[model samples]
Target: MIFIEHILERPNKKPILIDLRHNESETQPIVIFCHGYKGYKDWGAWNLMADAIANAGFCVIKFNFSHNGGTMENPIDFPDLEAFGNNNYTKELEDLHGVVDWVQNEFKHDNHIDVSQISTIGHSRGGGIVLLHASEDSRIKRVITLASVCNFGKRSSTIGDLERWQKDGVKYVRNGRTNQDMPHYFQFYEDFKANEERLHIESAVKRLTIPTLIIHGNKDTSISMDEALNLYEWKPDSKLVIIENADHVFNTKQPWESDDLSPELKTVCEEITHFLKQSEV
Candidate 1:
């Protein structure tokens, strides 16, 4: 397996760090993995999941959103809270476009890479980002969302009292594991308002013509199953899979110690691989 990882340098902008995982000797389809809110590429079993997917005969490109509070040096945790505070949906969408652009240029002539077949799988908020990107980007041939949230504006509304958030110019949400108060700058909501139509998930889903797979945990507390149903309903041909007793994170946590994926996540990976493989026909 060829595991090529590096930081994509950008001019006058935040740099993106991406890892390309696959067999260097064979031509392979590509899958880009997007991490959710307060999420990074290497979070939890994501790297393990990326490896598993790559090992199963596909190329997996996983990366961090430029402002996901992770710097190139320390991409694991919330080291740059200011960046996290300023992150918005529009910036994330731009980051996805940048990644796709980089993928196209960097591997334009690589015989081992089948660049024509591009797919995306995003978790939680990242799922929404992937869907929005797929709606507009013709290069994406397939999409698989894990525990995705359907409504971005509505979801951001839950971030502290709107009036207070505006008055203070920021609000804090506690990260249970890190015992840190994650700040959300008012600019996030401002950006949402500035481009609400562009960030709308349902509108984007209804616009997608490619094969789409929507998977959600029945017991997900962060995002409800109704959101998943909404996505399926918006897209006439999309498929929805509800896993029994799985949570928002598919029963897997960060700092995942074991070499093996949780049964639920393993099942999720299986579903993703099978779904992508069907397109080969």
Candidate 2:
């Protein structure tokens, strides 16, 4: 198998940190993975998951969103909180688009990746970004969302909180793990309001015609199982898999110590591989 990590740089956009995994096949189906909010490509057991999928005979590309608080030199942790503060849904969509375009055009030819058989998977907030992208970009053939948020506008704040946020011009949410006060600039809210229709996750899910898979943990506290139910309801034809006793990260944690996949994440990777293979046939 081949494992390579590189930076994808664009003119005006922040450089994206990406890693590719695959056996040295002449051509193979491709999987593009998006990390969740406050998540990076190399988070926890995700690298193990990518390796498993690659060994299963698909080329997997996992990336960090450009403005996801990580710098090029340091791909993990909140090194660039300023960028993180300014991040919004629209920028994330553009970042995903840039990755897809790079995969289809530049990365495809160079890496022997099959552009025609592309599939995308996103976790948590990334799930919402992928849904919005797949709805508009016909290049994506299949979609899988893990603990994804159903409504973007509602997740940010309550009406009273919004008033306070606007008055303060920023809102701080503490990162329990990092112990850092993460700031969300008022522009983040302004961006969402300006493109509210475009950022509506339900509308995007409703328009998605591709084979969709929704996976969530029954015990998730960050995003409830109800969000998964909403996603399934929006696209009744999509498959919804509920992992029993799993939590938000599906038994995976940051600063992960094990080389082997955690039991729950292993199940997730297996289910995803099966879903992608079914789509292939």
Candidate 3:
């Protein structure tokens, strides 16, 4: 299998990482994964999942968003919140389009890999992104979302909170895991507000003609199961799979414990494989 780390060009000083996993000799399908807000390319068991998908006869490309708070040197956590604050939904969608163009035209993959067959997968906010992008981009043949938000226009209604964020220029949200202050400058709200129409999840999902898979955990608190149901409701042709006992992350962590995939995640992966295969026919 071919393993490569490439620096993708972006307006930001720090270029995003384009991590590729695939066998050069085999002709396989392409799968691009997008990480959620505050998430990186190498977060949790994503690398392992990439390898697993590659081994299952697909070329998997995963990348960190340009302003996902992970710098090129340390592409993991919130080292630069200023970039994060400036990130807008349109920027990320464009970044994903860039990656797709690179993979399909610029980069050479295994002989078995089929560049014409491309699928996109995203988690949390990233999930919403792929959903919206697939609707707009005709090159995307399939889309999958994990714990995706159903709407991009939802914002906190507290006038006082908005006033404080605007007054302070930046607001900090606690990272329960790392215990660091996650900064959200007033620009984040501005970016979201400006691109609300383009980022509308329901509108995108409603227009999607390609096959889609919506995966969510029953106990997910960050993005509730209702969001997944909403996605299904918007796109009735899309398949919905709910993991009964799993949480948001599907029982995996940064320093992932087992070399083998978790049962919940394995199920999700299998479902994706089945969907992709069925689509091929």
Candidate 4:
């Protein structure tokens, strides 16, 4: 297996910390995973989930975005809140591209993966990112979103909050799990405003030509089923999977201790693997 974890550095930019998992003996399809807001590569059961996918015969690459609060040295949790606060949609998009560029060259000599068969899976905020990128990047053959948000602009905007955010220059959202009041500088919204067209998930969804898989938990309180329905509606050909009674993270939690994945997450992995196999056929 080509199991490796390293930080991909960029000139005058935050580095992306990535984890690669797959068998190096055979050529495989590529699957890149993008984590959601306040999420890291090793968050919760993501590593196990990635391993499961990699074992199912695909090269899985998961990365923490350059400004996702984590660092090259400490990638698990919020060690660099300042970076997190400074993060923006355009920056995340650039980070995803950087990861893709790295993967294409990392094992070129061994021919470990067919770069042409690249696909991506994103969760929540990352889902939107993947959609936006796939709309523009022809290299991505398939796209999957887990409990994703359908609209970035709506999620970030509220007339009352906007005025307060503008006046205060920042906003704080408490991370229920970490108990930290994460700061969001007004630039987050400003960035969204500046790149409104490029960052619109709805527009991206409408423009995509490749296959899409929208997965959601019926009981997800963070991002409702309506969002998944919206994606399905926009692209009727897209496959939609609804996990009964599963929460936002599909019943998985941070600091997940068990060696085994949650029953719901296991089912999710099976669905993902199945989708990938059939899509290839």
lDDT per residue as tens, model 1, 41-139: 999899888988898889999999999999988999889999999999999999999999999888889888888889999999999999999998999
Per-residue CA lDDT of candidate 2, range 1-281, in tens?
A: 88888788899778998888888767778899999988999998898999998988899999999889999888888989999999999999999899888877766566567888889999999999999999999999999999999999887666778888999999988999999999999999889889999999999999999999999999999999999999999999999999998999999899889999888888999999999989883
Residues 1-281, model 3: lDDT tens digits: 88888998756444778998887666788999999877888888888888878878888999998888878887877787778777768779888988998887754554666888899999998998999999899989999998888887774224568888888878777877677788777777777777778888899899999999999999887888999999999999889999988788776777686888888888778888888888872
**lDDT by residue for model 4 over 88-161, one digit each (tens)?**
88999999998988988876665778877899999999999999999989889999999999999987767678
Candidate 1 error regions (>4 Å): none
List pairs with backbone clashes in candidate 4. Answer: none
**List of clashing residue pairs for candidate 1:** none
Pairs that collide in candidate 2 are none
Ranked candidates (lDDT, high to low): 1, 4, 2, 3
lDDT for 149 in candidate 2 is 93
| Alpha-carbon lDDT of model 2 | 0.91
Model 4, 145: alpha-carbon shift in Å? 0.5
**Candidate-wise lDDT, in order:** 0.91, 0.91, 0.84, 0.91
What TM-score does prediction 4 earn? 0.97
